[model samples]
Target: MSVTPRTHVRTTALVLPAVLAAALGACSSFDQGTRGIADALTLYRPEVVQGNFVSKEQVAALQPGMTRLQVRDILGTPLVTSVFHQNRWDYIFTMKRQGVEPQRYRLTAYFEGDTLARFDGDDMPSEAEFVQRISRERKVKVPPLQATEDQLAKFPVTPGAEPASSDKGAAPSGAQPALSYPPLEPAR
Candidate 1:
């Protein structure tokens, strides 16, 4: 049986589209499979920290009758400020670190006529406690609060009298002179 030019053309036309479709489908599926494997094998996922991080010290500083601005200064701008609840401000913080359970904290501040009436939330961790927690979760050792006696002995002890200054005319060691510059022209 002789295969004519017309027959050859028809066969090629029919098989080309099917081959192309299969190749495209396989490429997409292969990419998806590889993506899944890559996701599973990923070792370093960037930690996600969202919203205002209010520490125990800041929360403890909060006092009743303080203005909204004062509360805002202590704890950064609330994450959830609802239009419906104008007087209520919600500060929510979420931290998601790879290989560790997510941590979430929420604090709701109720205002009565522009004054902070009350605040309700979880017992916040102090700065030191928070650092220790993070270090523990990350499998890192927390440094000792006080230096060892041997380490402290390495440094020379200072006398009660102040250190002699080489140049009396020069500014004090820790003093910083105020800087001033001319203001720029206002934009038109």
Candidate 2:
């Protein structure tokens, strides 16, 4: 039965290092865990919509001999037009929405002189189809629109107004009598 000071020192030296290493490891692991949590909680990415949108209907309306003014009227201003290629007009549309695949469309118009000679590009979605594609489906829980009798009872009746009637045609109890307003303009 003996305890040496040297042996105590040796034990402490080994155990201290082991404890310190474990504490350091735990702290690093905790740091990593917090990083993972931050990653899981994503930031909001705004939808990016760029360029003029040309719909299938608008494209369908294009004619081989339409004037440049007519083409401009139908499709709005072209997104890309180069001085080098004054006869050509390019329409490009791209949409980036969260939780949905990005959408892109392109349309090119070729003109001979002031008249539109031809037009072509990627098949454009109809307005409805485009709306559907860009829309993100969400399971929104809409609260009930109509209030219950208990909720209605929370509001006090107005002075000089009749209490709410059960009659289907009667106005709500707290409603004030309608007042006539002067015509927006003197009677024509």
The global C-alpha lDDT for each of the candidates, from Candidate 1 onward, is 0.87, 0.90
How well is each residue in 33-146 modelled by candidate 2, as lDDT tens digits? 899888889779988879999999999999999999999999999999999999999999999987779888999999999999998899999987777766677535658799
**Which candidate should be chosen as best, given TM-score against the real structure?**
1
- Summed backbone clashes in each candidate are 0, 0
TM-score for each model: 0.62, 0.56
User: Residue 155 of candidate 1: its Cα lDDT?
Assistant: 79
Error of 1 at 83 (Å): 3.6
Candidate 1: lDDT over CA atoms? Answer: 0.87
Deviation from native of the Cα of residue 51 in model 2, angstroms: 0.3
Kindly list the per-residue Cα lDDT of model 1 for residues 1-188, writing each as its tens digit.
99999999999999999999999999999999899899878877787778888899999999999999999999988899989999999998888887889999988999999999999998888887776655635556557799889998997678764566888777766778769756698667
Given candidate 1, what's the lDDT at residue 88? 99
